[model samples]
Target: MEMTKKIAIIGAGPGGLAAGMLLSQLGYEVNIYEKNDRIGGRTALHKMGKYSFDIGPSALTMTHVLTSLFMDCKRDILDYVSLLPINPIHTLYFQEVTFPLYSDYAATKAVIKTYFPGEEEGFDRFMKENTKKMLYISPLNQFNYSSLFDFFRPTTLRAIPSLTLGRSLMDDLARYFNSKYLRLAFSLQMRYLGMSPWDIPAAYSIVPFSEFYYGTFHPIGGQNKIVEAMQQVVTENKGKFFFNSEVTDFELEGNEIKGARLASGQVIEADYYFTNLDFMYSLGNKPNNHLEKKEYSSSAFMLYLGLSIVLPLSHQSIVFPDNYREFSDNTIHKKILSKDLAIHITNPSATDNTMAPINHSSIRIMVSVPNNTSAIDWDKETKEFRQLILDTVKERLDFPDLDDYIEEEYIITPKDWEEKYHVKYGAVFGLQHLTRQHGFLHPSKKLPKYKNLFVIGAGALSGSSLPFIIENAQITTRKFLQKENPSNQ
Candidate 1:
């Protein structure tokens, strides 16, 4: 009889759930310790009265990555979550003009040609080149790179040409077309990762390409259903869960972790340990490893509106500010709280009836503000900022009398994420994808000091997007599995 390998995971985030499902299927006795009474971490649902909203990641992209997770467990994708395609994937409200980006390639190309006229050729060329680029590097993001030497391995070497050197993601788009609106539609994907489009590496052009190529999807109930589904997979395979159990610290001897100490003073012993906690919150705290040198991703100011009526709009929309260059610069770099803010609105109820009351809207707004480090006072300014966003949405989009229709409202600022979510400085996107901070430069999935330790979530291997974070779990779990087998013979 063989002994079952016992593994303990510290968070119940999508990354943690992903790891638990995979490891349990591989026959590991797993226990996940989540601080909250509920699962899903940021992926969890937010409810105010009868209104339900997705607190994080309002848009679902790269859905094939999620389908692959269920397939790995030999389960039907539809068995866990039902997905509905969003036709006009996103309608861009760029100042005065309205652009509807369709899911169909021919339709989107037609829209681009209609608006910008001469730029359809550029869109066609981009679709051709970027499709090849994504094909080359998509496989590379799924592996762990322990060092620069590891980066030069076969997969990374093969992806070198697609790496997009000597320019930012914004500059790369400029090479394709002259329309800033078109450039913006493509570039918005990477910025949501808390990086400025002009600052992040050009390789992330894959964000929009993947979304347009694969099309966008919404779970029948909510994105949170995916979290619930993963939990089912974990327990069915014999994995255990401990909710509301906060990990206070770890018991370590030199480079190896022996056990994890909970807040109640009970320590859980395991053969191998993995934490789904945020990169900074897990480490550097009294109970976890912490590095002072690591910089964090930017935070957000979010509003979830439970309205009496739905707006006449697409499923998703972005309302760009008039001065986007200055807005992007100040929001990220100069650390100014601009009254002119770029707002993203997602009306989940428009597509999924379960998210809100009959015909009522569940609106999620994300305004990319600074992390908590700024001198500006959030406590005093939250009201004004909220009003500014609401005013802009109502006035600019001509959604008349929006103030009259609000039935309930919920808001989360950077301070809430820092204090409640316990992320490092409330970084919404985890680590910033700067030239000095991305790729092999970010934290490794396997910590250098601890032999039986691993990590997952926003800050790991791939960037923090849901699909990419799941890929991080796949990579981390594969390493442990390979180590267990050692050789096929």
Candidate 2:
């Protein structure tokens, strides 16, 4: 009788769940240990009264990547979850003016013409170049990162001219559009990765290309349904999941990770270990020896509100300040909240009734803030900052008597995220996606100290984003399987 290999996964995020499903399908006995009672790390949904808030990520793009994983594992994602396309993908509110960006290229072009008529030719050129860039960059995102120099190889070097790392996103947008409104609308997507357009590489504009091309979507029930579906897939594949089990430390023997010790003192061993938690957390007491510590991207302060009456806003709205640069720069050193900050509001109730009551609505207000874990006092700062955010949202959106309609409200500060998810400095995405730290420069999935240890999540290859995280899981699992069973291949 032959024994099957045993695998243990840390964290129940999308990356961990996807890797468990894949390895289980390959006849490996897999177990996932999650500190929280529920799966889906950042993708988890919180229910307050009748409102269901998507705790972290709001938009769902790159469905193909997810569906492909299901298909490869001989399962149908549609069977477990339903996804609906969101038209006009998102409504951009720039400098008090609003513009709708559609999934249809012709319609989007028409809207662009209306906003920046004189720049039509340049807009056309920009779209053509973006399409070309996406073709080259998207594949690189699906591959594993062994080293920074790998991207400079002959094959990757040929695509260097298309990467546009030489210029910033703002610099590239300025080359095409004369209207600051259009520039802000396009450049603001960089904020999704917690980067200012002036510092983010122009290649990141490929983000919009993928969204507009594939069309933005939301799961029919809520973002949480995606997690439920992944959970189902993992279970059906005979994988075990242990919730509320926190990992305290790794039990390493020689060059191999023997098992993980839970805070409760239980030990589970495996042949391979994949950690989906932030790479920094995996370092434990050895923070200095870990990847050179760099400042993480800005953490967000979110307010979820349940209203008695539905607001006339669309699914998504971005209210930018008069000076985008001021808001961007303030995040650098300031621990205090700003009145003229950028606000992103989303009404998931517009698409999913399950999120709110029949006649009511659910809204999430978000503002990026500095992770001031050291200087600012959270107890004093959270209260003052919450009031400031509420006042700013009302002033920008013209919603009167907001406190009156609020049936239920909850706020999540950076401090809350750090306490809940164990992310270092409460950084939403693992590392900041800057020019020098991106691509092969990001942490390698293969650890230097341990032979059987690997990483799969936002902190690993492909940067962040839901689709890319799942891709990292699939790619990492494939490499491990190949390494273990060369004869099978």
Best by TM-score: 1
What digit string (tens of lDDT, one per residue) describes model 2 on residues 152-255? 66657766888886898899988888888878777765347876677778888878777777888889768889988988988998899998998888877777
- TM-score for model 2? 0.95
Count of backbone clashes, every candidate in sequence: 5, 0
The regions of model 2 sitting more than 4 angstroms off are 277-280, 289-292, 333-336, 443-447
Each candidate structure's TM-score, on Cα atoms with residue i matched to residue i, is: 0.96, 0.95
Model 1 superposed RMSD (Cα): 2.0
In candidate 1 the C-alpha lDDT for residue 382 amounts to 93
Best by lDDT: 1
